[model samples]
Target chain A: MKKKENKIITDDIMIEVEKISMRFNLGIEKGFSLKQGFINLFNIKKRKELKAKRKKNVFWALKNVSFKVNRGEVVGFIGANGAGKSTLLKVVAGVMKPTEGNVDVYGNICPMIELGAGFDPQLTARENIYLNGAVMGYSKNLIDLKFEEIVEFSELREFLDVPVQNFSSGMVARLAFSIATIVDPEILIVDEILSVGDIAFQAKSEKKMMNMIGGGTTVLYVSHSLAAIKKICTKVIWLEKGKIKMVGGTEVCDKYLKYMEGK
Target chain B: MINNLKYVYAKYSFLLKQLVERDFKVKYKRSILGIFWSLLYPVLMMAVMAIVFSNVFKFSTPGVSYLTYLLIGLTYFSYFSEASNLAMSSVVANFSLINKVYMPKYIFPLSKCIFVGINFLLTLIPLYIIIIATGTGLNWAHLFLPYSFICLFLFTVGMGFILSTIAVFIRDMFYIYGIIITIWTYLTPIMYDIKIISNSTLQFLMKLNPLYQIINFARSIILYHNVPTLGQWAGCGVSGLVIFIIGIIVFKKNQDKFIYYV
Candidate 1:
């Protein structure tokens, strides 16, 4: 259960997250160099002190989180700040490994976890489109065929040869969103990415996402906008302090909203 | 495990090629010379080494051209050090992509080695040019030069994996590796002839370096126009295969933990 197993399945289940728990070191010095690592290795007293300090500093971001998503299910993750929504999504997307348990995802995933995650600012928008496509696991021939469509969707045809660093934030977002959604992924993992770009482009991207979802793509979406959740999610999982507080229909979103408002 | 290997191959091999290409484009983006700099770099370094050692230090090999000797050693050593150094920071440099995407982590370092290897192959143009200019006439033994290149490439990839993995945990690795490579370059007999060393034990120890084995094999084929001895052949191939195997094992063991650190 310690490994994330990405398998292909013939049945309906697309993702299975089993008791996945992730822990982070909350100490101020979260990272140590090899020099410090070596010093700690030789110093027994310091090692003992560090071990004791580690227990107090350990913070679990996700704990005993287990769930399953059927093919084409639009599942929304709702949580307050620091309630492990992003961490859970990362574990499901295979970006981060869980500390205790494992996750099994049964299909190709397009993780919109971070818009323009692999975009290099130094490269021109034309080059970045191909690079971003590669990062999302698309072959060159496929990207070549879809290149014109991506540029048209991004509406950056005039700025294709211009370096992405010179582009406005909206232009970058438009390019990222276009490349990410170009292919019809089997599982789409979105983490607050719908809020990208201007209002008009946001509407366009959401419409594109709805088209994918309508075509039987399983989606794991994390967002704070309850209205968006209620509109898009068929099921909602409300997380609280590293654990699931509720899992059900959109009514759970209503209940979570009440809980937040009451607090 | 076999199925997993196939899955990764089917999925990520194209991504690897793209990453290598990206490194190439970004590295040479603003430069006027573009990738021709790869060829000119070693040529310039060889000129400096020949002037300093042949004229000032009075170092020379009796039968072989000193410039050719220095170029071969300089070319290969730079390749190894440059590839590994770039690879050491490869994981940390790509942290933005690593944190958000699910691609295999080893691709970053492997891509760096490949990108540098392409540059290394370009440097060979100068290497062969100098060889012919020095009257070290081409011979049948030169066909075996690819053997040395293959061995050196494997060795560099192995070292890249290990260094990139270590870099994930130790941010200081970049600085620490700088000092180590400086010490290594001086020890590898790149400028001075190995025959000048007075102590047999010290010379034997120098021979223990895997880099020396690969470079020495290439020198034998190019400069001396002879096939490598059985010992040299074994030394080059065995060290590369052994180190590459160890590197793979080390990388695979630590890769899962990399997401936490990088």
Candidate 2:
């Protein structure tokens, strides 16, 4: 394991999350009193409570997580299905707040988490491009300038005026990817949005990511594809059950691969 | 505060424009009268109430025709009531945007309030014509209508900010709001005259309802041709500002958690 001192910030750190944790209360029920239940036996005073008691449950999605990413670094966050990777990414992107601790981020963040989430189904593809562009923090003028390029990238030029809900899932993914990468984001947080496209589109997305990294955009990538992570990420963070199992070079990922392979 | 305002405007200007246009377009899209329905609905309601209440209830109002008086009060009250009601659900309604973006949460309610304000102003054109057709001359105090509207706008936005924020955590707020608005409209003296309620105790209680002061002030200027009393105007100004300030504070503090709950 790397010592704590090794985690000290250097000159290029762009994102830092200090002791962050998120807790969600589930299964908490409200409405109906014991007295009301007893009185309802006679049906004299009817129960006004309409809602039934919901099951109670709680989840600690992320726990005491801490990490720092330097500028221009492409760090892959690899974990199992429930490993808190997306939660951590969302906190850094400012979409969700940490229940405890602090997250400090520098520069503009373009989060490609759940791409096409902001697109209105009733809106035309052209309108959705503008809407999604604005939601992703692009000014109208910038969206206008990139409009042609985005359409060309998505290969949906003929259907620009058609509503996005009419488009197939792969078409939506292509458009979402094109719109998300239209702006040259300083810090890009992509959460499995790129894995939906065809092989050709995947290659195109990989090329785009490489170009962005080459141009000094720091990326926090969360993906289950270990092969993709091995190819793109300069550093890797292996997470298990919301805890960091290891954080180091690509060698640490090899160890993780063996651990997963039951070798 | 100024910098925060600038930041908010710079960030949300696009969304504001989009939502406002969406509201204006979607509201009248399929209606036969289109935007004319803005004027028609209030006038029709006023006519019905004027006939039913003025004769059946025999309430005496001073200085203005009953139809004109009811139109003025109903027009202004409906603005606040409709804006606040829609604003109560603004945050929850845009769960997709709220979950994805991190802008000022207050913009959601404020945008709805502004959209309704534009509609309210449009509806006033017919009211002006109706007042003129009824042979009532205008007074200089009527110029103060714009200022009164500003006060009402601030108050509605404040209430919206608070209600929308609370509604996120409490799901039954929609039903609660329905009941509150139904009761509140009758209590605010919209269809009735404030002077007819002779009970001193009930009058005092009615005075405590902040909306009563707003509607009365509007009525005083537009229909009664008199400036609002100093105490009444001051109360409106002070309470509106206080609610707006506290509302922004609460919204800013709780905005981060809105994504989860919404």
Candidate 3:
């Protein structure tokens, strides 16, 4: 058996976000007309000499967010809708870049942010497993080795050869969860995906997550379930209106829950 | 450059496989002939054009029949045109995957190009049968077809990358692409031989269009049984390398902003 590495907190923060912010423009302007367009076209001689300045009209999705996650810590990011939880997770996963600050992450990240985003509807479940595994950065040999285990975990043995588009949402969720956990990444970032499966699948997913955490993997979990957050997370960060509201232990959940209820 | 290639291949190999299979399967799923449709469309187009243009124009294509000449040129041109059309919407078509996953964004465009390349390869079987059945002697230069295809593939990938990235930001790109492609086709010498242009100014303009050189290279080997000029090959090599590099730079720079635009 491969021995698990113990966590030593000697200035080894696994992930850091410093004043990270993301901005996006939301509206459109009037189109240029033929009269103004013709003048502007003739004015291109001057426009070529003068570099056109970019307009500044954009909204910030995340604002002045700063946090550090140490090794082997299970942190929950709880936020209301449009609170930038997904954006923050995407930035950490290296999918999206923050407009204002720097985000640094160490170690491999398996972001289960959008479960089965790479799935082809026409492809069979067996084919999708390999395709999904590869998309998640696993090699073909690695997928081959873990193929049986993933199929068993997904509980889709009979339907393995069936097209994924034919499968139910729960089945897809199960398959996605199984593929994600098969990799045993050093850092796992999950976003609101665990709530889709049934009670049994949820229990199985929780067990897998606990096992991953027990093996000293750092986790950043984003979900609306306060009960799940309280059960699984040791550290909590509450976000409201694209800003961090509070950071503390499970007790902060009570405050956040009250804030949500008060709204 | 090699490192970038490795990275792209590593990041996109899965998606490319899936898209290639999807491209082949989806087109043939309900049709009785399946993938034969890929060949049928081009063959039918070539036949119609050959008959229509052979009577109208009296230019002679040395060392090959007019049908053979037209088929070779049309086959190469169709690949380029179809690749650009597919690439125009590749990013938008895969918006769900692009918005969620962290892989190289160029994969969507490049995979679409590769999908069309596979279709081109499948379509070549009919071309080959026609060449043999028509008794056109297969020379040693025919073996260099793969190398020419690699050049064409690089060129298509470069163009696809640029167009797909632009399409993400520009809402009107989809509507404008067909008109652009129609104009580009006339600029290319697919129906007429490059030698037919007598004026020096028109020939210079034709040479400036990069697709002209690629199509000429393909037709020279396949139909004329002659190798492309040193200058033409050099133009293809230099342009392919430069465009590919530019495509990668543009794709990497703009990839982060795609989610916002989409």
Candidate 4:
């Protein structure tokens, strides 16, 4: 039992991303298959020079980005659309590999990047809960233990037997949120998850998130809600067009808010 | 990269079980008879094909009845077709999960193989019933059945891994593969005997087909009631292993880039 826990290292740092970068060729014709590539071998020199220009073909989602997240730190990400917030979260969650550099995570991460990601729409809510639990790598026994509590939290007690495809978007989000947050993860990466559901559910979810954050769980949150960021996050990192613009306390959010205003 | 097999196996088995079970349920969801459809499907096909072909095409199966011979070949061929075809689309079908989650990716393809395999195994109940009904008594050589199926299962899984990986990049594989499977079914000795080809060159090429070897190996036991020759056993064993190795190598090499392609 003593040897079961993760060995705590000398430092409390939970995540260290060293200059990670992701490059994608965006246009339809930008990337070539084996057949087209074989034909291009003879037309090499001219194509090589054209490739260097790139010109709307190659886009860097994240360029030489580096960040460190310590254990028990509640960090929030504030960024505009296309600021690479999702891409950065994806890289940290190990959902996607970077084209260059690496990410080292020292804890078991539960990434709620998109709620209800792997749910089979035809299955009942109860079935989807188990399916989603498996996606998060929870054992059947663990899910069996948490089953009742998850249902009670989602307030879908009456509709547990219904298929998820017939459920409203709010009901789906509520269910997804409850299952994803049931386990006490070392690192919780939340990407615009709190934006869904009603204001009442929003208050409940925020309380739940606060409870987890209060329990010394390291959180990496991405939300358009700056007030929520200022209220809950210990630190805020502001990104602008795939580059980290600022990293500090709530003052950074103030600066970002000011920047977002046309000042 | 897969050094910790025990841990990986323990963690993934539940996930795999859930995936396979879900697919199994979804399989018979729209049908009225549900899982009974599994039993009826192969039996009907075998009856129809055996009745038609037993008269028009007679070549080998020296010691056994035609129904027994047909059932053995049909079972292996059905397993091969279902397993490989399902496995091929496994990765492409789960694009939502693939892009959003961080799993080994092989899990999707492997789960598809196991899902189809469960159906394949269930069909065996009917297969043996047909054999017993045809007056072909079970013999000591029946023990070889499990091993032969395992070899075919491995071969299908390996091919699934390779084909799913390729299918992700080449969106046209669904159309292209339809034609290939049709041609492949004709090449294998499923409905007819391999001996009827007549031309030595064409006969030799037909023997080179992996399905021909696997179907023959299975028939040697269920149809002939004898132990397959060492050469036949080796051929089945080596082709499964060889194709499986190639599939794994190709799948692993391209697995990392699957995120981008899918």
* Top-DockQ candidate index: 1
Q: Which of the numbered candidates is closest to the native, going by highest lDDT? A: 1
lDDT of residue B171 for candidate 3? 62
Tell me the tens digit of each residue's lDDT in model 4 across A74-171.
Answer: 89998889989999998898888889988888878889898887898888898989888898788999999999989998999999989899999899
Query: Between prediction 2 and prediction 3, which has the larger TM-score?
Result: 2
Please, what is the whole-model Cα lDDT of each candidate in the order they appear? 0.88, 0.81, 0.81, 0.84
lDDT of 1 by residue, A105-198 (tens): 8777888888787888889999898888989888888899999999998888999999999999999989999998888888999998877788
Best by TM-score: 1
Off by over 4 Å in 2: A1-10, A29-56, A197-202
DockQ of candidate 2 (2 decimals): 0.49
Q: TM-score: which is higher, 1 or 3?
A: 1
Q: List model 2 lDDT by residue over A129-190, tens digit each.
A: 87777767778889889999999888899999887879998888899889888878888898
Q: List model 2 lDDT by residue over B163-234, tens digit each.
A: 999898886789899999999989888888877789999998998777877777877777768888998788
With a 3 Å backbone cut-off (N, CA, C), the pairs that clash in candidate 2 are A26-A57, A27-A55, A27-A56, A27-A57
How good is chain A of candidate 1, measured by TM-score? 0.88
Candidate 4: TM of chain A? 0.86
Q: Among all windows of ten consecutive residues in candidate 2 chain B, which has the lowest summed lDDT?
A: B98-107
